[model samples]
Target: DQQVKQNSPSLSVQEGRISILNCDYTNSMFDYFLWYKKYPAEGPTFLISISSIKDKNEDGRFTVFLNKSAKHLSLHIVPSQPGDSAVYFCAANLQGGSEKLVFGKGTKLTVNP
Candidate 1:
């Protein structure tokens, strides 16, 4: 069974508006959640992350929220710009050791000018 899932395959937002991407997980053992942004021809770059101990984490215009009880998480981008358009993937893993990351298919976000 797929442990991670991105229910929305895509999202669209007007420039300077907010963009929200949702994700859910079935694994309760996952403690570290991460969001990665991928450009068309490049590898995914780490965006933001949250530990199970924290409910939220933010960096600049990007924010990540985790609800451990619901096994759900979300990424929020405020004042999204056209350049921010890209595919975002959600990943989860155990806190330590050689655990591998389980990634969601990805959600493509389009920021319109």
Candidate 2:
């Protein structure tokens, strides 16, 4: 019963610093929150999204924050580069029709240039 959880599989940053990705949820009926970004094999892409009423959501350098009473959600990458190395997935869904997303087995973000 892993509603969602990303207990830091990996995270390393240096190039320009600033890169935090964390997510945890026990499924309080998940209210639409997503963040996906992958490279290698290619798949996850969506990046940034928040809609549990809104706690915060950015786009530029990517930024997504949601703390629906501590269900937790985070993804902020601001200067970190090196092409912002891959793997970063945190998702949740339950708002519209078909948006079934519940993934969190990623965090591998290595950006050390």
- Model 2 segments more than 4 A misplaced: 15-28, 32-51, 54-62, 65-74, 80-113
lDDT of 2: 0.88
Q: Write the per-residue lDDT of candidate 2 for residues 77-103, one digit (tens) a residue.
A: 998998989999898887666458778
Off by over 4 Å in 1: 97-99
TM-score of 2: 0.32
Pairs clashing within candidate 2 = none
lDDT of 1: 0.94
lDDT tens per residue, model 1, 1-113:
88999999999999999999999999899989999999999999989989899999999999998988899999999989999999999999986753588899999999999
> RMSD of candidate 2 to the true fold?
11.2
Identify the candidate with maximal TM-score. 1
Worst 10 residues of 1 by lDDT: 93-102
